[model samples]
Target: MKTDDLITVLARDSSPPWRFRPVLLAAICGSIIAAAALFFAGIGFRPDIAEALGSGRFLFKFVVTITLAVTASLAVGALGSPAGGVRRRGLLLAIAPALLAGAALLELAAIPQSQWGRSLVGHNARFCLTLIPLLAVGPLACFLAALRFGAPANPGLAGAVAGLAASGIAATFYAANCDDDSPLFVMTWYPIATMLVVLAGYVIGRKLLRW
Candidate 1:
């Protein structure tokens, strides 16, 4: 079939007019459940989680990660609409990194220079890199499949956004398991894992999301 014909088939709205947000919402919820299931099965929270919750650095991890997840998911959800509201909210994606950066600066100020290296290295760097993408597998698959229900002009961007959302979700779960709550570690390793997922999404999106 011709490219135009494929686009016509995908862009056509022959069936009843259904909302994409609700479907997107379902995808988000279902993705969470899937990721959580995989998480608990393989990696539960750190044994000291009860005590870790009291630490400001530890609690802040959730703040950054959940913000990433929410903002990216919001952007991905808007990709289906003709208005392209994702562009406006697209800046929201930076909020997580901004928060992390600010927190990292504060951490550097508060701690001695000698400790910065240790804090950045952390005990779980390898696990951090491995588990985040592993946990993101389910969410990324769901997000990619869900993208088909919408008409995103830039499928690659949409997929990358979905990857961000998936990575956020996965990182949130992995954070609980990770003992290293330093912003330095999160800033270094988490983005690497996220980029991996996003790269996969972009490559896959080019093929899978072609109208």
Candidate 2:
């Protein structure tokens, strides 16, 4: 075979490469597992879980808030990707999540001294600090995976996946460590801190995974 033909064959055979799939799969699975574990650990299928679920109002709000924030971050990051050089694209992706997370953290902190306010601050701070390691782990995995496999065709999707996974892992830790089981606790503080870390992941993914 001619050299050009051989090169073409090689490229076709190893398109996007295979080495990185395991890491990406692992990151995706790990995040999902972490979220499920936290859900079970937090309330199980017990009366508390049922009661919390029964309060349809709070449950609806919680789901909507978490879903929207995650979706929005991913969308924003994905939409901003340019088709050429890496520098501008990388910076834009990094900035979006960092700004979102920082803003969410600030919003959480800015609440006044009511009972809800105090609980939000206390729980969120504890959750944030504890999940720092796990939060860092998802991005590390993503960065390594991206380096080996090249950037995903859809960065927003990657960002969303990474964000959810990071949040889920952190939430699991929060469930295991935190004594508070109130829906109010989950609704108020959990989403806020989760979004912050997700934002961090988005920023990191953009910078390190310059495809």
Candidate 3:
């Protein structure tokens, strides 16, 4: 059966109205807190976090991740609505990438080309890949499950946005623990890890949020 038809049938059989916004908000807040708790309990911040905070590279990581999280969260809201805004919301996803690319360019200009490879292959590439998704688990689950109450025009797309949002939240936490703060490393591995979550969200959303 068509997803719309399925939803219509479900809606007809259901009596109570479902408010998507509050639930989504609750899920976002709760999931972020949960992720933070898990991060602190298990991994915690890096030993040199105080020193790292003074570094531009370390602070820039937060700028990128936070911007990504905010933008992606907004896009998820746009996508979750039944109203038309798929294109605009999709464009919003680009800001994080654009910022990272600009940072990478600056890094390239500031640092010698010979050191580029070393920075890109920083010490924690594997951990970055592993932990971001590990950290994303809560946000992704909360987002997808919360979005079930929403009438997103395209569930798959909504799910993907949720993935981006999740990754952003996760990356923000992981960055605290990660000692490697090079823009090259962030640009190289962060997106790969994000794609892992996004791909997972797309596949899962196709199945779980189809309507």
Model 1, span 1-211: residue lDDT tens? 9766665665564342556777788889988998999999989989999999999999999999999999999998877543355768868988999999999999999999999999999889889889999999999988887878777777888888899999999999999999999899889988998999999888888788766
TM-scores for the candidates: 0.91, 0.44, 0.90
Residue-level lDDT for 104 in candidate 3: 94
TM-score of 3: 0.90
What is the C-alpha local distance difference test score of candidate 3?
0.87
Which lDDT tens digits does candidate 2 get at residues 100-207?
A: 355445545655536555554454456445553454354435433533353444454455445544554445434444545444455556666656666765666666
Task: Flag regions of model 1 displaced more than 4 Å.
Answer: 1-18, 82-85
Q: Can you tell me which runs of candidate 2 are displaced by over 4 Å?
A: 1-14, 19-21, 28-150, 154-157
The residue pairs found clashing in candidate 2 are: none
In order of TM-score, best first, we have: 1, 3, 2
Question: Would you list the clashing residue pairs of candidate 3?
Answer: none
Model 3 agreement with the true structure over 83-164: per-residue lDDT tens digits: 5255876677788899999999999999988999999999999999999999999999999988787766677878888999
What value does the lDDT take at residue 159 in candidate 2?
51
How good is model 1 by TM-score?
A: 0.91
Count of residue pairs whose backbone atoms collide, per candidate? 0, 0, 0
The C-alpha lDDT values of all candidates are: 0.87, 0.47, 0.87
